[model samples]
Target: MVLPGVYAPQEDTALLAGALSDESLPPGAAVLDVGTGSGALALAAAARGALVTAVDMSWRAVWGARLNAARSGLRVRVRHGNLFTPVHGETFDLVLANPPYVPAPLGGRRPRGAARAWDAGHDGRMVLDRICREAPALLRPGGVLLLVHSALSDPGLTVGCLREAGLKAAVIRRRRIAFGPVVRGRERWLRQRGLLAPADNEEELVVVRAELPV
Candidate 1:
């Protein structure tokens, strides 16, 4: 389906796919999809019979997800708002997010178009941090939070953040992807922030699954 304004899904979507456990998802589950860029994960969950509420800060993204759902003949509620604003007081069995995770430059300038779609804040964890902070309240007891982001952003820190928020967190999957030279500046910024090391071996996508205590 041609989702309006969403040119493509993120490469990390593949990592998210591995993190999702179809069996762990309750039948007819209610799902909250945060940062529904292209609505890929949200659509997948809905297709599996979960009732989905997909939220995106971008109006284009919201309309795109709704278009995609219509073309797929699926029922998904698309909301335009940052994080969980549109779904206040609503809880779900699953909260999935593939947030903007690229660290911005020192001057705070960002790239245009699709590249802007993925640029997180300085440490590459701005949106991720917010999601981890907000997810606990949005999930029901025993519900799962699936997050896909870069290993360059300190996977340990991400896991720790989730745990501190009272969830059981673990790295469910990791996948390496070739880094293009275009992102070297970003790599350097991450290194300087101590989020990534100069000697880091490779670029990788990390999928973390955190579950609320039952």
Candidate 2:
């Protein structure tokens, strides 16, 4: 159930949601979902009895998630703003994110409409990098962060970023998925930049779990 201009639940969302379901959530665990487009991951956490707060930069997404959560009776608090900004100074027991991570050409204006949901800067680490850098601050000790993105954006780089920020991080899930429309449209540019090769129509996706020391 996704609204227009909002990112829909897809393979990556399913992978992350499945991971969330397997976790042993503490009593009333506080969960924050950054870049919560359709609130899919956030809803998963809420289902596990987590007190979920979801934030997104797009107002449409914020409302869509709020409405969806309400209909599901999930009690998610949805906010509209850039990642981490809307919930300033609030720490959580868990942080979850599915940020934009598709590498695209540089030198364009900010992505519009649904494109803003996935068009990351060249190398595809723009939003993911920011999440890695800033999310740790919103986590209490013993807190964990679950993040998902395409391997085309470099999962190892994400691990490195999280570890550098003082978290123990590792890849918890990896899957190969065929390129979606966005990637297919930008294949020529990706190949030109050596990020993709001829005949490459698929990419690997990864979920990294980063946790602070107990």
Candidate 3:
């Protein structure tokens, strides 16, 4: 069950899960799920025979994930920490992330409370950039990272950053979803910034896959 402040499973979650399902996981592959709010992706990986570890900055999210894992009878090591900190000095065969990518107004104070789940600062790359910078070091040779975010966050930049970091990255999945409450709420700001057209009622979500070389 999702805790009151935890991010619930939505299209982005399903998109990442679909990518995980398509991957050919080796026997007992080690998988890391960053920002694992409700532990859905961690549980999914565990159900597929993976040794999964999930981390979240929010204690509520960590507890909720553990609860969900227990209820599902899945063995996922859920920890409370930001991004990759909880899994430091370790590597995984696969890493999954569905970080906050919604662009909040410029110069706004950093998100607090539940807003932390989605109100990314400025260009919405606050969390995404950190993940790109740190994820490669946590991947075993040939390990893959699956990340999902809105096109508004600039997927091309993500690919470029990963490439510069020595990983082959590209957008492997795309889905156009109707504007959610967050986007709708920021309609004027987004349009002023040209992130959305006045008539645009939908946003395209993209899943980027980056792979480490052997």
lDDT score, candidate 2, position 85: 91
Better TM-score candidate (2, 3): 3
Give per-residue CA lDDT, model 2, range 1-214, as digits (tens).
6888898888988888877776678869999998899898888889878899999998889989998998898889999998899899899999989889999886756677788889898889888988998989999999999999998898999999999999999999988888889888998898898888787778888899999997
Alpha-carbon runs more than 4 Å astray in model 3: 106-108
Best by lDDT: 3
Query: Cα lDDT of all candidates, in order?
Result: 0.80, 0.88, 0.94
Q: Estimate each model's TM-score.
A: 0.87, 0.96, 0.98
* Better candidate by TM-score, 1 or 3: 3
Count of residue pairs whose backbone atoms collide, per candidate:
0, 0, 0
Residue 166 lDDT in candidate 1: 93
Q: Tell me, by TM-score, which candidate is best.
A: 3
Against the correct fold, how does model 3 do in TM-score? 0.98
Say which prediction, candidate 2 or candidate 3, comes out ahead on lDDT: 3
Rank order by lDDT, top first?
3, 2, 1
Q: Which wins on TM-score, candidate 1 or candidate 2?
A: 2
